[model samples]
Target: MDLCLFVTHNCPLGCSYCYSTPKMDVNMTLETAKKSVDFALSHSHDEFQLSFFGGEPLLMWDLMQKATAYAREKCSEKSIPPVFTVTTNGVLLDEEKCKWLKDQEFHIAVSIDGNDRMHDCCRTYPDGSSSHDDSVRGAKIVQAYYEKFELVSVVTPENVNYLYEGVEYLIKEGFTDITLNPDFYSEWNEAQLDNWTEQFKLIGNLYIDCFRNNSPVRISFIDSKIITHLKNGYEQCDKCRFGLDEMAVAPSGNIYPCERLVGNDTGEHIIGDIYNGFDVQRMVEIKNGNGFASNEECLECELAPRCMNWCHCVNIALTGDMNTTDGIVCFHEKMTIEIADYVGGVLFSEKNPAFMARFYGLR
Candidate 1:
């Protein structure tokens, strides 16, 4: 997990659930980007994920081009991990950018809520017009070249009932791999447990439906659990690439733990200056002590062995305590385990040994 880099904080959409809401800053300069990449490549890791995140990555394609070139130059010096991916709104991804993405071997994940109505409900241009059309067009533009990619739908109260409908639309659009993560902006409470249960029920049924139809899309969190169940892994703790295993460099040549933590009033300083050659000592200090202490829950969870604590950024934003509202998240962990156990048994049971064999490598 080298790090997930956020190219800039400039976004075109006015998504209501933008967790980085109050933290949104302006564009990162091209000069700063070059230096940050320099530091990152200097301290590259094997199997690293050089995730390009954004307001929208295309906004700084010039800087990204430099960073990509820097990665190649340094990796040629010594072996490093693959370039992980870029997650975007898919509004500006064009044919030229698509070619560059394929050339760079970058895995892409686009954010699309669902159909035009549901998507527009949350996703809109700063000008307040519907962004669904442009985003879909951009996605179609990228899909012309890329066959299978990742998409995450941010579910909300308004769209919770439409989970199945959204899945249907995504499958029809030719997406083979997709991930559904419900909106976390909604505060956590025992009262909302009913809503959580009902929404996740839709999510579970969506998986069953996909299997029944042999849908091509791979739902992220759920599919991950399926792999985990077969692999004998217990919990699903994958989070933002930047959270646990990743770091990020803003355009100012300042490096932070991840983009989510960057450009915010958290008063967390930019650990290192790429131009100053990545103050390794300072970065280590920031990455180790109080700054990183917010991940204590992940460090102490019983599931820590398998599930890395997911998102400290969101956890901190929602709950004043980093422990997740006195382990409110544990409910989700419990529910996921229950659901995974049920679905794995029903859909990929010993009776359907072929499914299990293909999916889990179990005979």
Candidate 2:
């Protein structure tokens, strides 16, 4: 089971596409955090992940520290080693924090849009000042301490054209693992969609070139799809595993299916509270009514097997209906799958023996 603990909904960066309700000054208490951890440990049989999430989890550093200590102690008592991860905006990270996180072996994910202009356009300080430089510096510090970390860059129509450039910038900055995701809920017009498709193709070609040259970078969005296809023939439902095997606990101990639905007003996404435990029936209903199950159009589409459709949370955010598929998101997914197929063909061809050997770990 994967437990995403929304430690706090308070953040310093004013990201334009931020989905969290950051105005609420909510922070998870140590007591609530411990209970949440206990709930996860009890429910999960063998292994479970404890993910620290927030408007910026680092904002509640003290609470985070306490929660980590408590979780470690409880996991030790239960004879289970805990897995830790943190997703942050990387604004408040310092040398000390970086070293501590490295020592603790936390899988860190830093949010940065791309280059300064693209990142600062959306991710800025409350005072409207740029946070790009500081965020990059933080990423550098974390990378210096830990060899493996992920850079998550959000792509909006405003910055979609610069997708390749942003990825290249991260690579130049010594980041090997990168994820570029579109602002799923944003309204993308025809031109933006076309541009996004072209940019994706360009990135795919670049990725292939890098692999051919023996210097491979992992672009999570594309690489994951390719890997999944190779492993299972196609991508499955891109649903948020909320309510099912995954759960997101708010600071107030309210349970949600995922963090994106943490502040939803409809109340339908709230399965149960940590104290009361998950309502099994509600969880069943959620799984039964997941995005893949509800969208008949998606099921019938040729790309359904490999397409990375929006999750329920993103579908709800984009179309105001969990079952409805966003046209732009659907288009982007198809484009991404097509590009992945092309890259797979190139990498697996007999002509590219060296690349294939390297890609398959034979090298």
Predicted structure with the largest TM-score when compared to the true one:
2
lDDT by residue (1-363, candidate 2, tens digit) is 688899887898878888774556778888999899998888887777889997899998998888888888888887888899999989899999988887777999999988887787788887889999989988988888887889999989888878878877888787888898778777788898888888888888888887777677888767866765776534343445656768889887888888778862236578899899888887776766764524678878866656555476777677766667777667777777788888878888744655566456665
Query: Model 1, 183-292: lDDT tens per residue?
Result: 66565555456666766667677666666665524666666666766666543333343323556776555666657666542445455555665456754543443222
- In model 1, which regions exceed 4 Å deviation? 22-25, 45-48, 81-84, 188-193, 234-245, 263-266, 269-272, 275-310, 320-328
Q: Which segments of candidate 2 are over 4 A away from where they belong?
A: 232-240, 264-268, 290-293, 320-324, 350-359
TM for every model, in the order presented, reads 0.82, 0.92
lDDT, candidate 1, at 307: 45
lDDT of each: 0.65, 0.80
Q: After superposition, how far is residue 347 of candidate 2 from its true place, in Å?
A: 2.7
Error of 1 at 23 (Å): 8.7
